[model samples]
Target chain A: MYRTLVGIGLICALVIVTVFEVTFPIIKVNKQRALENAIYQVLANTKSFSAYHLVGNNNLQKVTDNDTSDIYACYDANHSLIGFAIAAQGMGYQDTIALLYGYSIRSESIQGLVVLQSRETPGLGSKIESRAFLDNFNNIEIGLDAIDNERQQPLELIKNNSKTHTRQIDAITGATISSRAVVVILNRSLSFWLPIVAKQQEPIT
Target chain B: MSTKPGEIIVTGPKDTDEFIKGVWAQNPVFVQVLGMCPTLAVTNTASNALVMGLATAFVLLMSNVLVSSLRHAVPKQVRIASYVAIIATFVTAVDYIIQAVSLEVHKSLGAYVSLIVVNCLILGRAEAFASKNNLKRSIYDALGMGVGFTLALLCLGVVRELLGNGTFFNLSVLPGNFQPWVIMLLPGGAFFVLALWMLLINRLKQGGPRD
Candidate 1:
């Protein structure tokens, strides 16, 4: 009995170790490439980007330490700042929706949105990744307050085709919860980062 | 190996019988009703269903081959544990492979891919078929079962995608005015479709209509 158990254990260990060694590098490269692509995708018109951490009280701290909340400063072809891409997460219909979106400091609006990860229900909630839904973020104004404390107009999801307000997003039909979740996530993320972004100058990279 | 009383021993594989049984008589989803979780969860779209079915089939085939090859060496007492470990190793390998292929599909499949480790279909095959069979027969059994599973999933997926989204494989198949049955895209719809498939299969098995 003892010998049999040990043999099984050894076999399992060998298989696992062999597979891990073979696949780990490919998985790593794939993930890194995806991350880079997502960063560039969200912040369009970007020539390059520099990573920075958001430290205490939403300060733009240098990227000396590895943190999940690190923001990317996007630069244009002339090496001038275009915007910043920040990662955000919030509750969706079935799971937490994690995404990265670009914010244009000059226009005080979101440049674009890209879903990094979402477990939203297929055919409905998953429409959050649809071009129609994501296009709603393009140049949508997120006005900063006098004290830069709050957004002048909070993001809202209206029924599809009835969107009138600059802050309103046309929600996907039958996916109200998921559409609302995206709006809520955008609002929450903007509330935290917009103020800091508005106050800070382009960091020396 | 001595057969105990009432322990109906599986005979040496007659290639075609092993293969065809899985496709029709012993269809995992429609007939034997195994692996319901993935069958219902990922069948909302044909593409998602196809990818998921293929992934499960890959794991099933690899695990069956490994289990059959190791059957002689593994002792009866620890066989189940050994089988599970073997299945899990394959699942992890496929998981990484899918992640490398497409992050979108990987995310869509999500935890369901990992959950394949616990899928009774793969384990059931390993224990009931592979453990008692030789490698070549086990491979044939795995292939048939895998293909059967994929076909069953495709049926559900095609029906659901066509009715729920008015699209098949993401292309609009139904007329523009045709309103999609939103219910067909939800979890409740999955149960309805599977139940209907089972009912249809049962009726066919019973032959001409009977009160």
Candidate 2:
């Protein structure tokens, strides 16, 4: 009995390892493609992108090396800088909601948004991906003044169709918690990266 | 001895009976009522249901083949462990294949793919049918069960998707003014749909002429 169990264990391990070895590379490539696609999807009309890492807590510094969690600077066909795509995550209705959003340097507003991963409840909280919810981000202002430290309330989520201000997002009817979560994630992520992005916009020596 | 040492005595049902029983008479989902987890979770959309059904079928087929091939070697006492290990191997393979094939489906199905490891249908078939049958007969039985399971999921997926989202396979089926029943898209809706299907099948069976 002992010998049989040991033999079965070895065989199962061998089979699992063999399969993992064969498919690991393919899986890696697929993941890379997916990330790149998400970046391009959020930053529309982009021909290429360059990754930059963020360092420091308060005074953030951007580095070209890919050592840490990084953001992408997207360029159009003419090689002109279009925007930056940054990944952000925060607590949602059921679990963490991770996403990517395109930020326009010139306009200082979010261009688009794409949810990378989410564990929100289906049918209700999952409406975060719906066009009606995402359309609110199109050129919506995220000016530095909206940060909590400053006078303005950071990125407010209003009732559906009640978005009278540029900084306000319309919440899905039955997904109030999820909608608020998105706003909170965007606000936190934007507050941390906004200064660094502004510094990058300046002409270097 | 009365029987020759290598001579096999077939005490189970005929090969055709084994194959046909799974499709309707002993349907894994409806009759045996096995693998309810996936039956409820991934049947929200027709496409999700179809992909999940195919994935489950692949796992069931491979596990059945391997189990039947090794049935003689596995000891009676540890047979359950051996069957589980075998089923897990096939589930892992199917999960990776699905991820590589279509990330969207993989994402929608999510943890349910891994949950296939625990699905009673595959293990039940392994012990009840595959272990007692030869390789060819086991394959036939697996195919029938897989097809039956797929058909059952499709039944629920069609009704749920049509009512919940006002669409079939993501295409608009209901008129513009039609309001989708939001509850049909929730977890409760899965139970309601499956219950209705089982009731319908039961009523049909009872109403039909006696076999």
Candidate 3:
């Protein structure tokens, strides 16, 4: 009889612990959401946007129709439109890294970028998240060639360094591969978004 | 090595022997091949690897001791469930502590923190060592095993970071003129490093497990 009661008591103790365990994480879950939203606002530069609309499923804009990327679009106060920012993904040393980059049709340049996901070796290729690395895009163009094409060739980093590419940006020293991969993903993704931007820029009566 | 019916006494030097066995001799990842998921996932940085190792160690130590203390009381059919519950509680505690102290590390680790509850090494040690031994021995064994796992993660983190970025812990370790291997920062690079590391460890041990 005592053994059965002790077993019941132990089960109840476990049940209480489980209940407590399950409840607090739910509260923490909400706090986490708030923290995440605050971080997103900081990176999204929502203040610069006069008009911000959450688009697509859960307000995420699918960057590639193929669903390879997604981005949050921010418009300036004038509504002339600031830029098309999208989150892009590529393989890093140990894991996939997702990044948010803003391309401006008006400036014909990249405004900024933020690392959204990365499994790169810490203290190394993960520098993609560092402000120094990301700041490289501040004034760089999307198209690579000096010769203008009806379709702009998005900017990318080349290992050998070429002078002819208008869109070329300096790759991070010792992190050439990561730098180049980030550029390629940004360029490939911009190709898809540009047409949309061009279409959106079109006057709709 | 037989103890009570169905219980096997692990023959070793005993006492300190049980404690030191997991560090290099019976390493959970390289030597034992246990707990491969987190071993592969969170080793992108030395800091991250250290945090994960510490968190796992905390859980392993507590769970091993608790399970050992209650070994005889647990019914055979429900032993696994009981062990898991104990582990999950410790994991939740570690998660909260990490979040409170360093949100940066917490963010970097993400889901893998919670996933530690399921890591095989903790439960494996609990069942294999704790179930048959007294609490003191179990604690020692857990600590030793935890150190081994931590060392392995540190090795992976250092190799990947140095090759990929020419730096260690964000400090420039290589010359400015050196070109980093971009592949070292990619998933393919991780797999390559892991394979090479295992092979190196294997060769170092003469194609056999190290003691």
Higher-lDDT candidate among 2 and 3?
2
RMSD in order of candidates: 5.5, 6.3, 8.9
Instruction: Residues A105-168, candidate 1: write the lDDT tens digits.
Output: 7677788899988878767888999998999888877654522654343687799589787679
Tell me the whole-model lDDT of each prediction, alpha carbons only.
Answer: 0.81, 0.81, 0.68
Candidate 1: docking tier: acceptable
C-alpha lDDT (0 to 100) for residue B40 of candidate 3: 78
lDDT tens digits by residue: candidate 3, A49-141: 322233542233333232232544455555455565666677766677777666665665666777767766545676777777776666666
Error of 1 at A113 (Å): 1.7
Listed per prediction, chain B TM-scores read 0.90, 0.90, 0.86
Question: Which of 1 and 3 is ahead in TM-score?
Answer: 1
Q: How does model 2 fare in lDDT?
A: 0.81
Ranking by DockQ: 2, 1, 3
Kindly report which residue stretches of model 2 are placed more than 4 angstroms away from their true locations once superposed: A1-14, A58-70, A78-80, A144-151, A200-205, B1-13, B208-211
- Candidate 3 ranges with C-alpha deviation above 4 Å: A1-85, A89-96, A103-108, A119-136, A141-159, A163-166, A169-205, B1-45, B88-118, B151-168, B173-211
| B1-211: candidate 3 lDDT, tens digit per residue | 0111111334545676675577766878778988877777777666777889889988899888888988888887778777887888788777877765666688788899999988999989988999999988888889888877887777777887788777787789899988777666655666777778778777766856656
Candidate 2 per-residue lDDT over residues A45-146, each given as its tens digit: 888877766546533344654324558887888888877889999899988898899987767788889898897877789899889898888788776445
What ranges in model 1 sit over 4 Å off? A62-67, A121-123, A143-153, A157-162, B1-13, B206-211
